[model samples]
Target chain A: DVKVTQSSRYLVKRTGEKVFLECVQDMDHENMFWYRQDPGLGLRLIYFSYDVKMKEKGDIPEGYSVSREKKERFSLILESASTNQTSMYLCASSFYGETYEQYFGPGTRLTVT
Target chain B: ELKVEQNPLFLSMQEGKNYTIYCNYSTTSDRLYWYRQDPGKSLESLFVLLSNGAVKQEGRLMASLDTKARLSTLHITAAVHDLSATYFCAVSVAGNQFYFGTGTSLTVIP
Candidate 1:
C-alpha cells in the first residue's frame, strides 16, 4: 500500500502570508503534483515535479510555486496568499512513465483570510 | 494544449437508477483514468483504461474508453448511496502529465 501524507490537514492564514504545504510519499514515486480543487472547477494543477530539483507549471500555476529538494518530499508554496486562494490542496505521486495512475494524499484545506 | 470535459456536472438520481457519466478530451491519448472523491477527502483511483475498446468494472461501476473518439464513459448500475461522490476522468498526455476534467458530482437518493 502506498501512503502519501500532507503536512497539515487544515490551515488558516491571513492575506499576504506565505503559506507552505508539504507532501511526502513512502512509495518513492518519481512524479509529484500539486493541485487546488475548488467548487465547479475541480482539480487544477498548480505545479509538478518529475525529479529532485525539477519542476513544471500546470494549468493554474499563478500565485503558486513548488519545491522538490528531495525525492520523497514535495512542497507547494503560496508566495502571498489571498482570500481567493482558500481551497483544498491535493498532493499526488506516481511512478515514472506511462502508468500515471496517481496516489493522492489526504489533502490540505487552506483558508486564506 | 489538452482539455477534458465531463457531462452532467451534477447528477441526482434514485438509488436503483442506472446512469452514465461521459468524459471527453480534446486530444489524442490512449491512457485514461477514472477516480472518485468523497467530500472532504482525496480521490481514489477507480479504473485505468489504457487502450481503445478497453473496459474495466468493479462492483457496480464500469468504465470504458475509446481512443479514437477521445472519450471515456463511467456507468453506474443500480446506484447506491455509497457510490455518491465526485467522479473525475483524466487523460495521460505525453506519458507523464494528466489533464483532469471538471468532475461529475453524483447524488444518490433513497
Candidate 2:
C-alpha cells in the first residue's frame, strides 16, 4: 500500500505569518500535488510538481507556493498567511506513468487567525 | 481547460435505498476517478474508470464511465450509514492533472 504523510495534522498561525506544510510519500512517486479542499467548491489544485525542482501552478496557486527538493517530499509554503487561507490542505502522489490514481495524505487542517 | 461538475449537490437517502450521483465533464478524457471523503479527512480512492463504458464495483457502490458523453455515474445500492460521505468524481485529461467535481454530499439515515 502507498502511504502519504503530512507534517502536521492541525496548525494555527496569525495573520501575515509564513506557514509550511510538508508531505512525504514512501512510494517514491514522481508526481506530487497540493490541494485545498473547501465546502461546495471541492478540491482545487494549488501547485504540482512533476519532478524534483520542477513545479507548475494550478488553478488556485495564488498566495501559495510549493517545493520539491527530492522525489519523496513535497512542501507547500504560504508566503503570508491570511484568514482566508484557512482550509484543509491535502497532499497527493502518483506514479510516473500508466495509472493516474493519486494516493492522498491524511490532510492538514490549517487555521489562519 | 477541463471542467468537472456533479449534480444533486446534496442527497439524503434511507438505508436499503438506491441512488445515483452524476458527474459530467467537458472535453475528452481517458481516465476518471471516484473518491469518498469524510468530514475533515482526506479522500479515499473508490474507482478508476479508464475507458468508455468502463464499470467498476466495490461493496454497494458501482461507478460507470461513458467517455463519449463525458460523464460518469456512481450508483449506491442499499447504502448504509458508513457510506455517508462526500463523493467526488475527477477527470484526468492529459493523464497528468485531475479536475475534480464539485462533489455530492450523501447522508444515509436509518
Candidate 3:
C-alpha cells in the first residue's frame, strides 16, 4: 500500500515563530508537493520538488519555502508564522514521469496565533 | 495561468438519489483528476481521466472527461452517506503544477 505521512496532525504556533512541517512517502515517488487548503479557496500549491535538492515555487509560495534533502522526505517551512497562515496543510507525492496521480498525506492543521 | 471551476459549490441530497458534479478548466489540458476529502481529513484520489472521452466507473461513481471542451463530470448513481464529502477536480496544465477547483461539498441525508 502507498503511504504518505505528515509530521503533525495539528499544530499551534505564535506569530513570528518558525515552523516546519515534514512529509514522508514510502512510495518512492520523485515528485513531492505542499499545499494549503482554505475554505472556498480550495488547495493552493505552496511548493513542489521534482527531485532531491530541487524545488520550485507554486502559485502561492510567498510565505512558504520547501526543502528536499532526501528522495522520500519533503519539508515545508514557514519563516514567520502569521494569523493568515492558519490553514490545513497537505503533502502529496507522485511518480516522476507518469500521469501525476498524487497520493496525499493525512494533512496538518496549523493554527497561527 | 490555469483556472479550474466546479459548479454547485454545495449539494444536499437524500439517500439513493443521483447527481453529477461538473468541472471546467480555463486552459487546454487532457489530464483531469477527481479527489474526495472528508471533513478535516486528507484527500483521496478517486479518478484520473487522461484523455478525451475517457470514462471510468467505480461502484456507484462514474467519471468522464471531454478534453476538447475542457470539461469533466463526476456522476453518482446512488449516493449513500458514505459518499458525503468534498469533491475537487484538478487539471494539469503543462507541467507539474496542478490547478484545483473550489470543490463541491456533498451531503447525503438518510
Candidate 4:
C-alpha cells in the first residue's frame, strides 16, 4: 500500500515561533498538498506543489508557505505561528494526472500557544 | 473558483436507519471524490465518481455523481456503529487541484 508519512503527529509552538511540518511519500507522486482542517471550514488548501521547486497558493494561503525540494518530500512552513494557526494540518500526495484519489498522511495537530 | 458544499453539517441516526449526504459543486469537473475521516485521524478514500450517472458502491455505502448538475450523493443503506465518521466530497479541477466540501459529520447510535 502507498504510504504518506508526516514528521510529527502533535506539536506545540509559541506564538511567534517558526514551525515546520514535513511530509514524505513513498510512491513518488508528482502532486503534494498542504491543508488545514478546522471545525466548520473543513479542509482548506494552503499550498500545493506539482513538481520539484514549484509551489502554488491554494484557497487559504495567508499564513503558510511550502517547499518542495525533492520529488518525494514536501514541507510546510509557518513564518510565524499565531493562535489562529492552531489546527489540524494534513498532507496529501497523488500522481501527476490523478488528482481524484489522494493518499493522505496521518496529519499533524498543531497548537499555537 | 470551484466551490463545494455539503448538506446537513451534522447527522445523527439510529442503528439500521438509512440516510444520504449531498454534495454540490459550483463548476463542471472531471471527477468527484468521497472520503471518510474519523475523529483525530486522517482521511480515507471512499469512492471516485468520474462521469455523469456514475455509481459506485462498497458494502452498504453508495456514491453517485451527476456531472451536469455538479452534484454527488453518498447514501448509507444501514447505519452501523463502525460507520460513524465525517464524510467529505471533493472536486478535481484543472487536472491537479481539488476543492473539498465543508463535510458532514455522521453519528450512529445503537
TM match of model 4 to true structure: 0.98
Q: Candidate 2 overall Cα lDDT vs. reference?
A: 0.94
In model 2, how large is the Cα lDDT of residue B69? Answer: 92
Interface RMSD for all numbered candidates? 0.8, 0.7, 0.9, 1.3
Q: Every model's Cα RMSD, please?
A: 0.9, 0.8, 0.9, 1.0
Give the per-residue lDDT digits (tens) of candidate 2, residues B22-107.
99999889799999999878899999998899999999999999989998999999989999999999998678799999999999
For each candidate in turn, the TM-score is 0.97, 0.98, 0.98, 0.98
Which tens-of-lDDT digit does each residue in A1-113 have in candidate 3? Answer: 88999999999999999999999999989999999999999999999999999999998999888999999999999999999999999999988565888899999999999
The residue-by-residue lDDT of candidate 2 on A6-106, one tens digit each, is 99999999999999999999998999999999888999999999999999999999999899999999999999999999999999999867667999999
Query: Which of candidates 2 and 4 reaches a greater TM-score?
Result: 2
Question: Candidate 3, which segments miss by more than 4 Å at Cα?
Answer: none
Q: What DockQ does every candidate get?
A: 0.81, 0.84, 0.83, 0.76
Per-residue C-alpha lDDT of model 4 across residues B1-110, encoded as one tens digit per residue: 77899998999999899999999999989699999999999999999888899999999899999998888999999889899999999998886788899999999999
Per-residue lDDT of model 4, residues A1-113, tens digit only: 98999999999999999999999999978899999999999899999999999999998999888999999999999999999999999999999554447889999999999
Q: What local lDDT does model 1 show for residue A101?
A: 86
Report RMSD for candidate 2. Answer: 0.8
Each prediction's total of clashing residue pairs, residues at least 3 apart in sequence or on different chains, is 0, 0, 0, 0
